[model samples]
Target: MAKFRKKPVVIEAVQYEFGMEDGFVVDGRYYDKSGPVPRAMNRIPAIKTLEGRHEISKGDWIITGIQGERYPCKPDIFAATYEAVE
Candidate 1:
């Protein structure tokens, strides 16, 4: 079992790359191998994606769950749905 996250977290859009390739999802997201890079995640790698939890995938915004788990969120719905919290 995993711990539940209750508070809204700050998330940012990023460019996803599997290696020598580069491209879209515009929002100017990309991966820079020169420095601190984000870990790749998928539904298989995600600790959640069950029930009402957000789905994780490629070309999605990386959101930090309440308990500090990082997961992917769809771009369009991510913009239309959640508001940034202070």
Candidate 2:
């Protein structure tokens, strides 16, 4: 077996937190909001991605891939995998 390395790429991401308003759109790029369930019940925030609807926990990073796909990454994994571009 041969080892492979990941190619360097820059991606756009946003850290989601509690109390972020529904229908929140940041920089006209990120469109994050609460799920259909009422916030009173404390349902996790979710977004539609290339794969499917994924729940986003607090401090999770929403990443936009090079091909314009979106997905959620846990904070710890994100920290280990990515860095500030500038």
Candidate 3:
């Protein structure tokens, strides 16, 4: 038998809305990608309940949360939108 470990990769994203007529929103905040942005919030936020509550929105920050989730914030919105919690 052989033991294998998983490798981790990093990605970048944003949290601004494409537009009211383009994507979806949660808690009155845009979470999906749409309109003329280079990349839309095409991926749905992933939620897990392993060690604790985990969530990763479409346009979340590159950093992960305590529960291994990502803070929801559009990349286009720049650093003014959301801040990853420590």
TM-score of each: 0.34, 0.71, 0.21
Model 2 is weakest, by summed lDDT over 10 consecutive residues, at: 21-30
Order the candidates by lDDT, highest first. 2, 1, 3
| RMSD each, Å | 11.3, 7.1, 12.5
Comparing 1 and 3 on lDDT, the stronger one = 1
RMSD of 3: 12.5
User: How much is 85 displaced in model 3, in angstroms?
Assistant: 19
Give Cα distance to truth, residue 30, candidate 3, Å.
22
- The most accurate candidate by TM-score is 2
Writing each residue's lDDT as its tens digit, candidate 2 over 1-86 gives 99999999999999987664244333333344543333344345666788866767788888889999988899999999998988
Q: What's the residue-level lDDT of 22 in candidate 3?
A: 32
TM-score of 1: 0.34
TM-score of 2: 0.71
Q: Give per-residue lDDT, candidate 1, residue 30.
A: 42
- For candidate 3, the 10 contiguous residues with the lowest summed lDDT are 16-25
lDDT of each: 0.46, 0.71, 0.41
Residue-level lDDT of model 3, residues 60-82, one tens digit each, is: 44434445654443455646644
